[model samples]
Target: MHIRPEQAGDSHPIAELTRRAFARAKHSDGTEQDIIDRLRKRGKLTCSLVACLGTEIIGHIAFSPVCIIGAHNQHPQWYGLGPVSVIPAQQRRGIGKTLITQGLATLEKTGTAGGCVVLGDPGYYQQFGFMPSPNLTYPHAPAQYFMVRSFDSNIPAGIVRYDAAFDT
Candidate 1:
């Protein structure tokens, strides 16, 4: 298997894989695939990576800019990570993990990102240095399930607003 940035041809495959991956997820809204499409259309998909075996795309991950709503009204440079998907057949085989690790690395290397946030199982995300902080929150989910990994010393205090596509 190989991991790489998503190519033009990977879109539909990624969507199908994502749909299959999240079909039974406990917290999925059943629109994960549509969210990706909307994000792409809005030009908000900052990083999209795919894990492939041979010519088939088996997993996918996406990172997009998030706004930290605070006193200043606009908190730039922070991103949201989510909707990571690995096909049912490939789940637990480390494909999602690799996509996430590589995606975060790509974001950090940009030198513009202050941090990344994720909403998911604490046990899984913590291994990647993501932790819940009283300083940051997401109004739509339980605070503990929302985690943040800051590249720098500062983890801003505010409500994290994901892209509008997430509203789909």
Candidate 2:
């Protein structure tokens, strides 16, 4: 298996993989794929990565700029992680984890080390240093499901807002 940055032709497969991965997820709103599409259309998809087995893309992860309401309303020092998808057949094989690790590392290198937030099971995400942060929030989602990974130990206290596409 190879993990790498997404290229020109990966979009369609990424969308398919996303749809198939989240189609029946208990917490999915059935719009996971659409979120990514909207993120791209609005030019907010900052980092998108894929895990490929041979010539086929099997998993995908997307990261986009997040706005910190109140105090730190400036250039994005943070990002949001979501719709991390691996085909049903590929689930439980570490593909999602691999995509996430690679994606976060790439984002950190880009000077976005402020942090990244994810709405996911703490059990799965905690291994990556993600923890429930009452300091940050996404109002529409359950607070307990919101996890954060602060790179510089500077996790800000603010209302976390994802791109407007999330509302679409």
Candidate 3:
């Protein structure tokens, strides 16, 4: 399978894939797709990637800017990664991994991103260099589930506020 940036026509399929992918997830509230749509509408999707086998899009990942409100009052180019999805039939084939790998690589290449934060399983995200930092926390969730993968040594400490689209 190949991974590439998402195109305009891939939106609907991505939505369907996201819905089916997270339909039964223990932590999903069933609005993952809607979050994507809102992010797109608000022009906050910093990076969106899709994994495809031939002409079919099988997996997807999204990244958006996140605000880090710290005591230092520094707002770096940090981003949030989430809603990664692979169709149930294609799950566990490493499509999700490929999508994340490619997406993060793209962000790093741009040299504009400070790092990325993800709210997910520590075991799964740890492989991607994501670790819980006492300095950075998301108040809405447990500290263990919120992980950060800094591109450099400077990992900020503070409350991470995802885009307003995620508030719902």
Candidate with top TM-score is 3
Task: Point out where model 1 deviates above 4 Å.
Answer: 71-76
Give the range of the ten consecutive residues with the poorest summed lDDT in model 2: 67-76
Model 3, position 122, has a per-residue lDDT of 92
Give per-residue lDDT, candidate 2, residue 155: 77
The TM-score values for the models, in the order shown, are 0.96, 0.94, 0.97
lDDT by residue (tens digit), candidate 2, 104-168: 89988877458899988988999998988877887877877899998778878898888898886
RMSD of each: 1.4, 1.6, 1.0
**lDDT per residue, candidate 1, 13-46, as tens digits?**
9899989999989988789999999999999999
What's the true lDDT of residue 92 in model 2? Answer: 92
What global local distance difference test value does model 3 have? 0.90
Reference-based TM-score, model 1:
0.96
Order of candidate numbers by TM-score, starting with the best: 3, 1, 2
Off by over 4 Å in 3: 71-75
